[model samples]
Target: MNSIFLKAVRNIKTLQYFPTNVVRACGATKSLHTTNVRNDLMEFFDIKKNWNETNIRVGRAWKLDELRIKSNTDLHKLWYVLLKERNMLLTMEQECYEKMNLFPNPERIDKVKESMDNIEKVIRERNIAYYQLETGETGERPVEDVVNLVGLQEKYEKKEYHIPRFMNTRWVQSYLDHGLFNSMAIKKFYRLYREKQHNEERKARNRDMNHVIQLIKRFPDMDMEKLKAEYPNVDIEKAKRSRKSRGHYVPKY
Candidate 1:
């Protein structure tokens, strides 16, 4: 009889706890149903309401002057915002192409890019100014005129490398003997290149001379000073002696 009473009390306790557990579970489910699920990445996209629209209007990019007034901290934060906006716009554009739908306001991407470019420009200006003030030099890479392997001049930006100049086999080979540019074949090619350049210049000069002659033939009373100003390279007196410059009605000086 005592064992039966103990069993009955245990059942009573289970009955009491069972309802509370069920109620707690039910409340948890209800809370879950009421809660909102957020996706941060999708925030890069425009709002859902505008997603299917054919056209989405947006304002112009951030101007340089406007950015100039902003503090560096604010500009830094704004850069991220513009970057995110650009990424979102690109994503949307790609999706639109994939779906065969038109990307609304394609210029929005341009605006974002322009804004980012302006931000970079402002930052560079600040960096340059800071460097000038502190070190009497701009923080930008220094560029100098360098003769390339083919005997052409190029603007070379000086860069620092871990290796020494002598260790760079490729550079030494290109600039020194046994290189293509140092070979007889390259010398012939360079000669031909110079000839071609000379031929083009000669042709251009002849064409200009002929054109000036025609102008003189057509307008006999044209201002010689103006003609000289326009075609300073042409020998106007020499062109006047040409048979073409003697127009049908003109013996007029």
Candidate 2:
């Protein structure tokens, strides 16, 4: 298994998975060392150990803090390493499932995914910082609230284009010629959608009010502070004053 790890690591440079341009973009130079890989299907299938064994050993997933400390080049390499590991784990799992065998330590998949996610987070942080320093803005895609064709407000992620919307004939034709937004059906849909949303909000408010009243009635000496914390919208004092909140018990004077 250890030898397999080395083989996979060595094979990464030769597999053409990381193109020269991409590696250079990561500020990584080509590794001086080179070794031959079998270049076989076993690369994906048999890389992971303990496929049939109950006791398996592997290191913990990469933590966000740990990954953040590593250089971009190291992260670039680690990302691909995790990517290959993930691919092998999925392939092994599928083969095991098809063969009616239980996959050992399915949590390995989650570990790889978490590591990849952390690495991405670190990369994104570095990117945003670099962009802010260099260009006075985060390099992430610009997003804004935009009304869709259906009249509902939604997030619109802007895309790069060679021409502006008004100048783009295809875009202009599709949006301007098709008066979908002005149709009676669309207005009716927008009206009904807004009404449905408002109705749900109202029902939820009433339900919370009724539930608070019940709690007040049942547990007269209950922890009102905790109840208030849980349902911040419920008016505890108002619920206490409500007729339904009065207990159905006669006090022994």
Candidate 3:
């Protein structure tokens, strides 16, 4: 009977210790699992084993037509893959620079970027088609043709506002009531701009005319059709009559 009591006491102690050990084991397992997951995630930024080698070959960028054939879910997943690839390439490049080593195959970065851009374009096309089918709209940013403060036409993207347009005193005054775009200073600037543009055009014409004259003086038997095509803006016939077009030698005309 005494042995039985001692055995019961030992069993009770075992139960107490067992829970503590189990708890510790569970905590260790949880920590190990977390660490494994973290390592897997870090794989996104890792480069290949042969990255440090001299020559690294890679494939071409994802074409738009190829991406278009993929399902939306597949495309979405591919975008993340490309994004990870770009990050990895950038990381590898930075590391190589830090170590004063050559980065292998810089075009890989371009390929990944191109693929990402194509994926986005495909997604956008799908979005537009879906929106048009359901809502009769492209579901893109709404734009309106507007004249800017500089009197130039621009497509103004519509944005959300808290207050009504009429209630916005500062905006109304700047763009409408007391707009500086229509001021006398702007008119003066525009006049000067126009004069500068005219001067440039005049100078360009004179330069081309001079070139045509020089060519004729040098190459008397030059292809007239080719010369005319080369100097479309310059009056070739008028240039031929110029004194500069005549060579130092006696005219063969």
Candidate 4:
């Protein structure tokens, strides 16, 4: 009877210890699982509250000075956040436009664009700095100023060539040959272009001057400041001094 009682007591102790160990193990497992879930959620998306807001008031763009201070990882995270915000704003604006409603503030798009641009600029600056430190080069795309076939100077981005410059007959003929620029056809085209531009300018000047003349003729006491404001380029003082501006009545001098 004594041996049986001792055996029963040992079994009961083992059973009680088993529950305590199991509870501790379960608690540890739950802690590990909760940590993993929190990290996974953080990596997946932004905070939830911004999901359903009619108007999200965000501050201005990240200025270059502000961006310059951020570390690479911080800047990378910021870039994605701004990108998602831009996409969201664009989607909302499109929906609003589709409904034929006015977008409350179209400047929001401009602000987002400015932010993205600043981000890109910051990245580019860092890249250039890294490149220069390691390789002594700005690491930027090369460009050159060249005269086109029409004899107009233009900025051209330079690209690699399989053959040397002297060996490229086609490029040489197109770019170096003065005959292309001095051709009769090109000259005629340029002349016509200039004449068209001149005609447009003349028409605009006459139209504005005539409008000013009518205003002056109708309102002899028209304020010179107001006239100047209305037609900034029209030399108001010269127009007033013109014989056309004189009234029919004799001079009061």
Residues 1-253, candidate 2: write the lDDT tens digits: 9999998777775656757645665566665335667688887885444665865677899999898789999999999989999998899889988999888888999999999999989999999999999999999998999777787889989998888889998767655787777878789999999999999999999999999988888888788899999999988788888888888775211
lDDT of 4 by residue, 157-246 (tens): 888889999999887787676578878888898899899989999999988887787677667876879889979989776676666666
Arrange candidates by TM-score, descending. Answer: 2, 3, 1, 4
Report the C-alpha displacement of residue 55, candidate 3, in angstroms: 3.5
Name model 3 segments beyond 4 Å from true: 1-48, 97-101, 184-253
Residue pairs of candidate 3 with colliding backbone atoms: none
RMSD (Cα, Å) for all candidates, in order, is 12.8, 11.5, 10.8, 10.1
TM-score of 4: 0.52
Model 1: ten consecutive residues of lowest lDDT: 29-38
Candidate 3, 24: how far from true, in Å?
34
Per-residue accuracy of model 1 over 1-253 as CA lDDT, tens digit each: 9999999888778758786555464577455434345578786677798889988778999999999999999999999988878888888888889999998999998899999999999999999999999999998999999877676668999999989888888778777745766678778878998999999999999999999999989988899889999999999898888889998884765
Best by TM-score: 2
TM-score of each: 0.59, 0.68, 0.60, 0.52
lDDT of 2 at 53: 84
lDDT of 3: 0.84
Candidate 4 global lDDT? 0.76
By lDDT, the best candidate is 1
lDDT of 3 by residue, 1-253 (tens): 9999999888778758786555464577455433234456556555457765888877899999898889988998888878878888898888889989998888999999989988888888989999999999999999999877766668999988999889999889988897678898777877887899899999999999999999999999889899999889989888888899999887655
